[model samples]
Target: MTTNNVRGHRRRLPAIVATVIATALTLTACGGGSDAASDDDAATAGAADDGSFPVTIEHAFGETTLEEVPERVVTLGWSTHDIVAALGVVPVGVPETWGGDDEGYSEWFRDQVEDEIGGALPEILNYDDSGELDFEQVLALAPDVIIAPVWGVDEVSYDRLSEIAPTVAHLDPENSWSSTWQDLTVMVGEVLGRSDAAGELVAQTETLLDDATQAHPEFAGASFVYGLTLSDGATELGLYIPDDPRVRLLRELGFVDTPAMQTVLDSVEGGNWYGGVSLEELDTVEADLFLAWSAGPEELAYTLEHPTFSRWAPIASGHYLFFEDEALAMATNGPSPLSIEWALANGFVDKLADALAGGAVTVS
Candidate 1:
């Protein structure tokens, strides 16, 4: 059995009364009626044809049935907005992205919205300083449906969001954030009544990855360990499990998991996507290539100089890559069709090639 470790990662929210009051005030100040109607029209105009109405979707929180094709949609998690927008539906509200561009949106998402979809950008539902989701903002949007297939939505939050609209939680009841990009795309397509389009998108993405693999034979069977060192003074290393999206993406690119990863998985006792290993035992988690992200240059330097970590095989042989660009890291962490295409168009593939060649490399 696995435990729900979400509370440790996310902050508890404020009381409902305060959230309601804030929602009312914010709506009143923004002339909610007219603005909402206009946004709704824009979103509806761009949406794909209505699928069979009254569709029922089973999720972590029982089941939710959509009586009709939804117009105004709200998304709460990393790739849901991207998938929705890619399927030709503009979301009315989307959770703020941490490594996003200046507008709290990913570059690919913005490009798709502005250049391809030609619609107004969705409102960003920002978390508070304490990492609390802005429930007030979500309520103010008055979305017809809420998509959160890979979010950390607990029972209380699910019930509350259901009161606002038909809310869909994560796919797995036992794991909060374990959905794959393909599954998410297909699910969102089903919700939007565009399964055919979703399938095509998936096929195209697969072809893109396949072509990359064929082009770079070196990636095939290349053992790797993807992880990160927290800013907590580099005391421990966080290794992503096989089920994690980041690791899945690497596998799709033709990389193989190191034998050490199975040992880490055996040690992990819960549904948590990551497991920790002390810096002292870093050498035990061996791999041909070590890919990771750092808080900054200082942290990277500290990790490289650490007594135990410095002696790790990959680091000693310079077969390691670190990313300082949060945007790139986010793209890889939860890849969508849009982000994958953008990443390839950028220099992500080339960077991997460089890392495989050997030498300490960092992408800033």
Candidate 2:
């Protein structure tokens, strides 16, 4: 936890609700107009220019070079699918999103592929909640390259995947799952041979974030803590590190994480980056703003009624933000260009601004 005064994040969205498109994507959208053709083109396109081939890239595990631009890309881990799809290339396979649609896919990703690519949903890779990879299922996809550069694929997993295709694991062991969206976009773009396009994407995303802070100056002074809160008898608080994408996202929007919370995180000892604190220590970690992630409305409601939870300053001052939507949570957990748009479009900035302005707890 380098503690550069970072803060909180979470995103949950309803299903993509376009007039006809909404009804059409019941479970899968296979029979369609330009959508089918769009997917076909996106699925088979080469990632890089001819001159960009044989490019060597390094990661936590090792380096991989693509002798030729990859036509089939298989993405394992969060956010990779959207990054690839946003670049006008559809992955042949994708990881299971945390709170995706019934198809077990992120709404932003599903809609983008349907509306932009005009294609059927990509194959859902065998990725479980535990981040385990289904080696056999991944192998059947027969991808030209495997992208997991921002995921937590260990040595064994990397070694296995590398055997099938040139696999790119997490960029560093020290900061697992802490890869910035820019790094993820650029790396995936490089692997696909779309470095220029990737650069454009990063610029666009940065501009989007700049526009957000510019729109809401009130967010600048507030401090926040991003944590997951469950209402079960045992209520544990999962305090995400400052560098975690969720926390970094809030920092991007112009808020800072509290120093008190940083001390609590620093005391935590583990290879994994998050710290575990009891709800009893809520007051010990001070922040002008507090963001708590809940599984749903029911959970959020239950958490608010906890013995000590209700008395926390943020909660008492009504300066806290409770995230109850699963899709919205996933979007903020590790934002990509597409997911960030979804968060903004769905009032992420507005809620934070409301929190800074202060009146009642902002629950979304």
Candidate 3:
């Protein structure tokens, strides 16, 4: 729909996560105590699914149990707040959305929290520069349960938070933030004793995605590469692995995961589900579409003008989806029951259709 041109740019997050082998190695040694678990069992047995008191959840670091339903829940990672709110409970504390509007709230999430809490927002939990959870702030909230199913909490971070409350760590060992929307909903539902509601929410979202893809059959079998960074000095392109929530949504919509990209992921992912490769090496870099985060008009334009960028088939055909809005960029970052609808209401579906029909827009 729109267009621009420039020379070179690299869109990357500040903290590039590497293998956390050492951090996870100390988990059992640093995990929490039974006193808090026992206390939770005694105090919260009133909140259960048909007398399903004392639900124990096992995650990457360790197992956490909830005795009664959590009254003062605090969500540490992305989009879990949306899940908690959808299940009819507002968290006592949530982190400000780093990729959202200036108010540190995603547009969709902001609207939901306001409506649910009668215009009251949850307390802000902060992430440090290196993306570490703000433990001190979480402690101050005095929450009953800390749900972070998609968080990248190391053993030290887990034990430290567990000292305060039962901490639910990541569901997958391969990556901390790679839990899918279903995984999150079901896990959080068990923790909150709302399993039926969570299952319904998951079904609704899956239907929404299925309907959209059915309507736009062109998206089927369209291979895509979700890239956020292209190394400034080298020809390396930072690609999100298949496990990332963002890529998971794209695949859900019927886009084929390029075998080339999958192979690259196996090599560099180490213990985490993210990796990068030199653009010069892969004939596999080409895909039916290229979805990316644009730093700005000028930066994206610069990348487009570069010879290296043109080497990819998608770029040559202008089959790329560029997202300039931070909220839109993060629309699927945590893909909860609420956020999936947000992406649908936004232009994600239409953009895919447009790109499939050879829509060329640099401005987004």
Q: Would you list the C-alpha lDDT of every candidate in the order shown?
A: 0.75, 0.72, 0.69
TM-scores of all predicted structures: 0.86, 0.84, 0.83
Question: Which residue segments of model 3 deviate by more than 4 Å?
Answer: 1-48, 116-119, 128-132
- Runs in model 1 lying further than 4 Å from the true structure: 1-39, 42-51, 230-235
Clash counts per candidate, in order, are 0, 13, 5
Q: After superposition, how far is residue 59 of candidate 3 from its true place, in Å?
A: 0.6
lDDT of 1 by residue, 1-364 (tens): 1111111121111122122223333434553222233534435222233334568888987988988667788998789998887766679899777678777988777767665657889998878797777787888988889999876477888888888999999988889788889999888877875565677778877887898888889999999998885564667788889989989999999999988887778767677888877777777786888889888878887877877787888888888878877777787888888778766666677778778888577877
Query: Best-fitting candidate, measured by TM-score?
Result: 1
Return the top candidate by lDDT. Answer: 1
